[model samples]
Target: MTSRKEHALKRRDLAVNKLTSLGDRIIDDVAKQTVPAIRVPSRGTSNIVYDEDRRYYVLGDRYGQRSLGNVKQIKKIGQMVYMANFCKGLVQTGKTATLREMYYVSEGWDIDFGDQQESNIVGEDLEVTLGITREDLGLMPEEDGASVYGDITLKDDDVEINAMRMGKSGYTISPTIDEVELLDHNVERVIAVETMGMFHRMVQENAYKKFNTLIVGLKGQAARATRRFLKRVNEELGLPVYICNDGDPWGFHIAMVIISGSAKLAHVNHELATPNAKFLGVTASDIVNYDLPTDPLKDIDVLRLKELYKDPRYRDEFWKVEIKKMLKIGKKAEQQSFSKYGLEYVVDTYIPEKLDAL
Candidate 1:
């Protein structure tokens, strides 16, 4: 078996090769006294398509041209070159930078980025251009990754760590797991929760011990790192994943994104999407079934549900039925809605009932 270190090294070497090729192309164009142009893969929604075999959304074959011939695009080309050079330096040194750090780093460049959003796009351009992930290019996440708690053991570079020994706060999932090794697991299933509050409550209740499961807190719509880690847990650890979140339309979309992949990140869906993951989160029907307190749905929420009903990912009968039920009820509930009974209600009552049905 290839060790995790070897895998990371191979990825690093691939990134370096791509970066060098990009630089050579620009230099060759300059030496030939021609308008230097590069074809950047389109990251737009129009270029996103569902791959039935892969079971995820991926980028279609559409390219955008960045050329020095166009004065309007000169600045963009400049920014791309600078960003590529920076990433090359990072890969060469075996160092990593967060997107935020890249934004700040751009301030020192001759053609600096207008803002963080612009900086982020340039970084993404490199990934699509190279056919690799930002992580592969030595880019880290600007925000910290998600939180996880369970009866599991992981090794991060020479250190052996136990999830149980980490206490109630548990372990915060790192931005990349390329070098992290899963040594062993005492868990049976994986519960991926959206809110930190509910995740902490479950941990406080000894749900991991009681249920023999790993609990991951996604902290809203999961970032790429979190989704990738969940894929690892489901595939490598052989643990089934069930997402838990609010009963709102956004919550439903979050779960679907993990299962079917989102258009915004279609390029890296193969690394991030986990189609086998199930959405066991709240449903609008829960309002009537459990007599739970709920706030009236906003017009936006209704609009979103109508849109989801037409989304290819939500074509399943289970989603359509749930969307209609939510529309009929016109209300939504949070995961904490179970707390109306007691703090232990989620672990002792609600979760047990849901798991038994599964």
Candidate 2:
């Protein structure tokens, strides 16, 4: 196995090689009096394929689009060059920068991005073009979207974290998960929650102890670090993972991101997605079975459901039935709705029932 330091060096070398090759190509194109073209993964579900064997979504080799002689193409080339140089600097200095910092850096360099969103598009393109993550470019996200609680220990460099021993609330999962090593854990499974309210409820109720499981809060969408940590736990510890989210479209998408990976992060999907993770609750049938409270589906929720209903990645029979049922019911359920039975119902009744069914 390669050491982390060695891996970082290799990644840096690869980035440098790519930059050198790109520069060579541009010179060659100029010499030949031809257009300089670059290829990037298409930024949508269309170019993303579901790998049944891997149980995750991956970017396909389909030719998305070619940047040639258009003004947009010229602008993209400039952005890519700038990003490559930025990454090179980070590698040379052995430093890291946040996504916000990168955006500000671009602004400081007088990159003509209208807003942060535009800057992010260029960053995504760079990831696809380089076949690496923004993190590999030494850019971190601002939000740390996960928290952990269980009989687990993490060793990050010289610092050690015993999650279960970290007071009553447990440890906040670090954003720099790639730099951390999972030293030890003695848990049967990991239960990942999508909402903070339910996560707090589970922690307050000692759900991890009751079920002999590890609890992680996604806070909504799982961050790259959070997903990477989940992947490591599942692969290294050999623990079955379960995702708990609302029955709404957004919650379902969150689960999908964990289980199958997202198109935007296809470059690092293998390192991030927990392919064996199962959906534990808030299924459409739970609406009928548990007699949970329901909120009327919003316009956006309905639109998103319709989109997922037709998505190729969501073609499973079970998912199809679930979405159909949701459409028919015209309502969505939250994880918190399980509280209707009792505050302890989720930690005691709902979780145990779902675990037994697994």
Candidate 3:
């Protein structure tokens, strides 16, 4: 296995090579005295396609171009080039920046971004063009938003830390997960729960010990860091990844995002998606079968379910069947609904049944 330092160096070199390739093409285009145009895969909704084989969303054929000749797009082209240089600098110098910092840092650039969103688009444009994730380019999110608790041991650089030792809050998952290595672990599975309350209960009850699994708290929609960690757990540790969330569209989409990748982030799906991850429970069918306490489906919930019903990722027979059931019942269930049985039911009966089903 390659050492983390060596791996980081190789990755940085490759990123710089890609950035240099883009630079060379633009320089050559300029020398020819013709308009320099760079074409990236269109990030529009219509241009996002689900790859059935890979089981993830990917960029489609439709192209969005930034050309020097197009006055409206030239400013963005300048930002793209500058952003490419920024990424190259980051990788070369062994430094990092947040997207917000990247936006503010542009104060020094001639082709400065108008706002963080504009700067973010430039960074995303680089991602689509280079086929590299923002983390690989040394740009990280403002905060690491997920936590983990379990028997798994991880090596963050050279220091080894036992996840279970962390209190109820658990270990904060790192967005730049490539830098961390999984150490020897006794965990059999990884269970990622969507709610903070449930995560706390699991942690407090020593659920990891009960199931011999690592339980990660997603703090709602799983952040990039949490998803990356889950993918690593799935691929590297060969542990099954299962998500337990509500029986609504939002919860369903969260599981789908972890499993198949979201359309908005198609470019980095390979790095973040876990195609084999399973939705543990709280399915529309589970809502009926478990007879868990439920709340009436809101208008927004119905709309989202309808949209997901048409989404290719949710086209599986199980998804189709469950979504129809939920719509028919006009009710949604939450993970907290399991509390109706008792505080221990989720960890004891409910979880085991779902695990056995898998």
| Cα RMSD to the true fold for all candidates | 1.8, 2.9, 1.7
lDDT of each: 0.87, 0.81, 0.87
Q: Which stretches of candidate 3 lie over 4 Å from their true place?
A: 32-34
Please identify which of the two predictions, 2 or 3, would achieve the higher TM-score against the true structure: 3
Q: What TM-score does candidate 1 reach?
A: 0.94
Worst 10 residues of 1 by lDDT: 172-181
Candidate 1 shows a clash count of: 0
lDDT for each residue of candidate 1 in 269-311, tens digit (9 for 90 to 100): 8888999999988887667888888989999999999999999
In candidate 2, position 188 carries an lDDT of: 91
TM-score, every prediction? 0.94, 0.87, 0.95
Candidate 3 residue lDDT tens string, 1-358 = 8766677678888889999999899889989988898988789988888899999998888887788899998888889888889889999988889999899889998879778988898899998888888888999988785788888788876788888787768789976677777877898898888988999988877789888888888988888988888998899889998898877899888999999998899988998999999998598778888888999999999999999999999889999999999999999989989989999988888888888887
By how many angstroms RMSD does model 2 differ from the true structure? Answer: 2.9
Q: Could you give candidate 2's per-residue lDDT for residues 1-358 as a string of tens digits?
A: 6654566578767766776676687778879998877777676767777778887777888755555688757776887778778877886776788877887888777556777787788878877877777776777788875888889988876788898898766778766677676778888989999877888898899998898889898888888888888888898779988999999999988998888897766667887888788888698888978988999899998899999998766888989999999988898999999888889998888888888887
